[model samples]
Target: MMTTIAAARSAGATRWTLTSLSLSMLLSSLGTSIANVGLPTLSEAFNAPFQSVQWVVIAYLLAITALIVSVGRLGDITGRRRLLLIGIGLFTLASALCAVAPTLNLLITARALQGLGAAIMMALTLAFVSDAVPKPRIGRAMGMLGTMSAIGTAMGPTLGGLLIYGFGWRAIFLITVPLGLLTGWLAYRWLPADSAKSGARRSGFDVPGTLMLVVMLTAYGLAMTIGRGSFGWLNSALLVFAGVALWMFVSIEKRVASPLIHLEMFRDPDLSACLAMSALVTMVMMATLVVGPFYLSEALELDAVGVGLVMSVGPLGAALTGVPAGRVVDRFGARRMTVSGLAAMVIGCFALSITPAEFGIGGYVVAVAVITSGYALFQTANNTAVMADVIADQRGVISGLLNLSRNLGLVSGAAALGAVFALASRSVGSNLAHPDAIAHGMQTTFAVALMLMGMALVIALRRLKAHGR
Candidate 1:
């Protein structure tokens, strides 16, 4: 009778664990893309410039990028379940703060806090899922997680538009409040308790290393943010700060007993290749995301709803492909899928760059969908490879590192690609009324993206060769 009861309890826990994790993944991923549709509304409401309002997005991403690794390491030391619960609670509260914020500054601050919560959640969701699911089904589970994230992200623009149209820009932030709270409650109840293997008492947090990493990431992100306009790339002090912080961080990591990042992890050629490919692919995705809405709104004269629908195409494509791609990864291995996906992205980028302005919304939709489909394939395969390469005990930190790569790509891609568009627009005269100039700028930006994608393809090819598969 005791054995039967134990089996029933175990079965119950298994069922609820994935559901809770998926909810957390959906909310966190939703936050990343939801605000995008409201960017113009936010600028108008706060009476701020586009550049200032962009921080609503940037601050969130920067906070996530800077803290993900540390928080993941913390999860390793404390307990993943504990950290996940705290993350959900914090995220819910921060979403409330964001909705209520009066000033643009306060909104950005709240978003940063929201990002901190997201970092914790993002760092652990995969690790938790991997731990809970059986080995044979891990690939499918990851694919499903990816699908949830893709759906959430893809749905963001449409949802945000509808909310903004019905309520206001604040509605975007407010909507997450209920979802986050419910997820938190479920997580607290459903997630299994931390085991002795969590190493809570065995490991020590690396304070100096953590601090240096924050400084480095902050400086680097700031440099990228301010690289354009009056600041210009050459005169930014943030670059020097980034350089100094990086040197100090490397030095400190070498001396620390338990570094925030295990530097030696990069020595594995497979791991390094997977990480690099992840960053580059994510960079391409962000470039499209940042530029696509503007192009649709300005070039095609689309309304908020129209823009949202159009932007949804890419993520929708990714969502559809995610599960199938995961199965492919499980069967055929990562190298082939990664290479094919990168090639597809390269083709998509090239198509977008050369597409005639006359092709309008339809052409753009096709291009974006192709890009996202490629991303879905590449991400699933590469993520699976990354997890496969690392040891079981190191999953937490490695998950953190993987998320770090993605966020870095996100932040850098937005800044750099936005800068390219800004400069190109300036070259054609910065008049917002000039459709020709805007078109020119958009084309130039995509051309640059094409070049970057080509480079990524080369890297993927090299990675494939290195693995000899």
Candidate 2:
């Protein structure tokens, strides 16, 4: 009876622990998506130009990219549970500030602070899974997190639109405050206390490496984003600075007693392969977001509502498939599932590449659904493979690295792949190219996207071989 009762209580605690972590993922993703819908409203409220109001979104993203890994390392050295609580609190407070800020600059500053909290939340949530769940079930746990992310992404715009329509823009920010508070309480109540042994294992923090990485990542993000889809000299200068920062970071990491990332980890073929494959996969995934809207609007003549409903199919598919993918990963093994997912993506991309323009939304939706379902599986399997075997001490930083690779892919996709579409279509600004030109552009972009997916598939196969699959 005692053993049974103890087991039951333990299971209950695990459930709540996962609930808190899922909420953390949801809130962080929600922060990103919700704020995007408010940009126009914010511009009018503050009487600022689109470029200035755009910083509201950019600030949050830059902060996350720049600080995610550092915060993850901080969680390792300090206490993940404690740091997570502080992160939830900080995010909550920042959201309140954003709700009340009278100026755009103040709102931007608050958004950056919220991003810092989000970085901690995003980095630490995955790290906590090993603590909260069994090894056999890691895939399912990862899938749950992915599902939350999908749900958050899917819900944000619609939720924001409803809130803004009913109560104005501030309501969107105000709404998160209560959710954050609840998440904080759940975390404090359910999450395991930090192990003293884990904290004692580290001799010191790698301050210099952390700073250099922040500089490198920030410079890279700015270089990709600052020009509004057009590269400039400023972008070139930032890239150069980023290159220098990368060198400095490597040098610092080599000498640090406790490094943020294990320099030698790159020597592991599996680690290198997974990172590269993830970056490549996400880069291709971004093409749909960047190019799909243009194809629908210009080539197919979809109105705003039609375009939105079709574009939503991807996130909806992801949300629906995430848990099932996780279950499949657990049953079939991560390596096999990873490769299978890539194969599915390749087929989807190939179909999209040759899809007839006359089929319009039907063809586009089918291809997108297939692609996103594959993505949902790939993301779950890849994340499980990385996190399942990671040591407790290294979990936070590794999680950060995984998230960082995805962000870099997104940034690059928006810049590089978007450029590929624009140049191929001969479109200058907004719809300067003819309808036929836009249709040709869609075909060209997916052809390039398919090639990228092929490369990722090759990487996945090699990784499978390396692991003796």
Candidate 3:
């Protein structure tokens, strides 16, 4: 009787565990793109300038970037299951706080906490999925997670817009609270206790190293977020903070007994290229998000809802592409798929760059769809590359680094593109009737995106050829 009960419990736990992890991935990816539709609404409600409102978006991403690595490592040190549940609970609470916040400052702070929870969910979802499934099904499981995540991200704008129009911006955060709470409860009850990497013993946490890393990432975020706008390039304070933080981060990591990051991972050529490609792709991906919406609303005179629908194309493409890309990667290797993906992205960005406001709303929508499809293809292939060569014990670290690279790209993209558009718009001057100013700004931003794609293309092509040899 005891044995039978234990077996049934194990089966039930496996079922719930997979379900919970899937939900976690969906939520994390959803957050990345969902708030976009509410940007205009939030700006109006909070009585904040556009640039400041942009921080509401930036703050969450910046927090995620700064903390993902630490949290990923800690998850491995502790148990992935326990950490995941903790993250979920925290995230749920933060969501509630965001829903009821009276001021922009409070909302931003709550979102940051929400981001911390997101990092935990993003970090452990894959590992936990692998643990629950048999080895033969791991590839399929990963592909499914990627697909669902892509769908969530792509649907963010549309979903957000619908919610905003129907029930207001508060509903956007509130609706997720119940889902998060349910996922957390399930995870706690079902996730196994021994989800840590095998033979990975807990050394005392590297307190100093961790602090330095956080300081470095935080400084980087601040500098990127405000350096160009508030201080300009010549600001001594900005330069000093960024420089000192980076230097200290490097120095601390090199000396720590159990380093937060294992520098030795870069020794493999494939891994190095994968990391570089991931960073570049992310930079381009995030930059496009900012530029695409601005172009639609300002240049084309589309409303916020219209921009959301148009912006939805890229994520939609990604959702359709992820599963197929994963299968292709498993069969033909990362090199071929990655290179092809980059080529597609180049075409898409170029198409979008050349598209004029005169093309009308339908034309612009088509252009965005073309560009987004390429984004989807590239992301799926690139992620597969990162995961392919990684050992089981190190997946969390690798996942953290992948997320970090992407987040850093997001920060860079937002800052660089935001500054460029703002500068161009200023030169053209603030005549709302003359879409030319915003048009020129949009063109400039797209050109920059094109240049990024070119670099990524070169890297992906080189990697492909090298692998072929």
lDDT of 2 by residue, 50-90 (tens): 88998999999999999999898889888899899999999
Model 3: how far is 48 from its true place, Å? 6.3
Off by over 4 Å in 1: 1-15, 39-54, 102-106, 226-230, 233-235, 301-304, 424-436
Model-by-model lDDT, in order? 0.84, 0.90, 0.75
Give the alpha carbon lDDT tens digit for every residue of 1-469 in model 1. 9999999988788778878888888988999889977899998998898989989988887888889888888888888898889999999999999999989999999999999999898888877866787665666667777888998998887788889999999999999999998899888888878888776544578899999999999888877765334456553688798899999999999999888888988898778877877887788888787778778888788997798778778888989998898888778877788888888898888888888668998899888888898988888877777776456556778899998888888767877788788788778886854666667777888898888778778877887787688
lDDT of 1 at 153: 94
Give candidate 2 regions above 4 Å deviation.
199-203, 427-433
lDDT of 3 at 99: 95
Clash pairs detected, candidate 3: none
- State the displacement of the C-alpha of residue 52, model 1, in Å, after optimal TM-score superposition: 4.9
RMSD of 2: 1.6
